[model samples]
Target chain A: MNEEENRPVRWNLDDNGVAELIMCDRERNNLFTDSFIDAFLGALSEIEKERPICLLISGLPDVFSGGADKETLLDLCDGKIVVKDLEISERLVAAPFPIVSAMQGHAVGGGLVIGLCSDVMVLARESRYGAVFMNLGFTPGMGTTELLPMAFGPFIASEMMLGGRMFRGSELAERGVPVNAIVPKADVYRRARRIALQIADKPVDSVYLLKYTLSSEKRKRLIDARRNEDLMHRITFPMPETRRRISEQYNE
Target chain B: MTKEEVIEVIKRNIVENLDDVEADSIDATKSMKEYGANSLDMIEVVSTSMRELNIKIPRSELAELGNIDELADKFMEYINKG
Candidate 1:
């Protein structure tokens, strides 16, 4: 087995109040296991406590996150973990500071959910990403329904979600995905950090106010979308076809 | 577009976007924020007004105009400059 990074999600706060959350659980492909979820929440608590002016979420050299762990889904079915699912995306989206998602490799499913929650996104020109819940044999668990359409508009969002398409960053740039920049793989972090610094340098009060203003529509819509998705997820997770797909995908 | 035409466009945009504010009560000197125009409403005002008038209002320049009169004046300046 390949060794995972000691810290899957590492949080760093600079003196200027720019915080970076690095995801590096390579062994598990950065899947959302119990450990990852605990670390994720703990890191977010620290970020809230530290009151960073802006946030940057990036991943290891070539891989961002693989998405929700199928193992975790089983636990969810067994009632070991209660899934308040959408709140995860909401927390990042509603964070007081501006967020910049710097994507390297591919961010899919829950990973894509997190990226879309941020205010601005920058993808490595060579990397790929997708909202592939359909491939996982379930309706979208995260608030991707609203986030996808919000980021890419109705027509593109429809094709991506319904078709479960994996999109190259350059292709998305060409298709007019509203990403802030499509930089080289090596430059993803640097570019995102620069943008985070620019946001942090602004008046903190107004920065937060503007985030609240801009995100209000999406935030509200996500709350409603999650309520319906919750029912859909519960219903679909137990279906025979869903079980077959999950088993095949994970080779269970 | 004449200054009168520009003013008409701005006023029409405000009335169309903001439901709470009636067109008759849209005082030119008052801030649009006072008329219950939130950030999204203001964005709509800027976009629709610019599109209708066929003028480029840089996003940064939007912060400088506080009231309907000021916005109308800026639009007139842009039209005259063109």
Candidate 2:
């Protein structure tokens, strides 16, 4: 089966002008496995072609994402599937519209990386955020190493990924994740919709131009960093320690 | 130590290490996540508890405990099991 068949991304442009990219696959907590990436890339392409005024990327209600699927990582230990996730993450960073992540709970590892690609992040106050790769014996993937340090600065991002620390939404907001507001879990989607509507209410051309203009400088650097990270991932995947760590975690 | 004393140690550890975990009265059954314990924090909690109680726990076993009471119970179990 093709990647999209296993995990599909749905796009719904509502009458109110909120373009929603809702991710399913709650079983793995919507970790954006390889299939999830394939479907999401396709959905993003469709949205770009249609020129949606504002975009809201969300997940199944309670969980935003638990990060990269470990089972999927194990399946492609040679970093084949991980590279695919990196490609999708780059596309998300370069998306034309103002992409807002409506994060609810447990954004970790690559999940937080994808959320960072957004123009604004609206988090549920009680949700958890982490750059969790180091704990799993892997480096940050999917542009996290680059975007995080750029967004959050070197020391903070180092503490997150290298220290394998996780912070609550309110804490992350204080630390500069652009978490504008927090509300009740039920209000996450509605809050995102309200933000999108506010953006849509503006003059479309000006909004589009502003979005492109702001992201242009950082976009190329991030895309290049993603390529470097992907190459490093391929090299790191074959190390004896990497194999032992994976075996230790999964084989038990 | 009294159970309250034990709870206090747990509370202090959580507040000191895990960001946003308030030092409020906590039910043992409440999720550690609800109390702002992430996976890394949980590992620290287990490791700290091991030093206090003198025990070693497999990380897999740590995954089975969900809340403060369950974590305390698992620590006790591991101590006795050892």
Docking class of 2: acceptable
State the weakest 10-residue window (summed lDDT) of model 2 chain B.
B36-45
TM-score of 1: 0.71
True contacts kept of 2: 0.13
- Cα error, residue A122 of model 2, in Å, equals 1.3
Give the per-residue lDDT digits (tens) of candidate 1, residues B1-82. Answer: 6776777787887776654457778788898888866543575677678878788756666777878888888888887888
RMSD over all Cα atoms, model 1: 18.9
Candidate 1's DockQ is 0.01
lDDT of 2 by residue, A95-146 (tens): 7788888887667787787778888777875566778776667677877878
Interface RMSD list for the candidates: 20.5, 4.1
Chain B TM-score of predicted candidate 2 relative to the true chain B: 0.73
- The segments of candidate 2 whose C-alpha lies over 4 angstroms from its true place after superposition are A1-8, A79-82, A174-178, A182-184, A247-252, B1-8, B15-24, B27-56, B66-70, B76-82
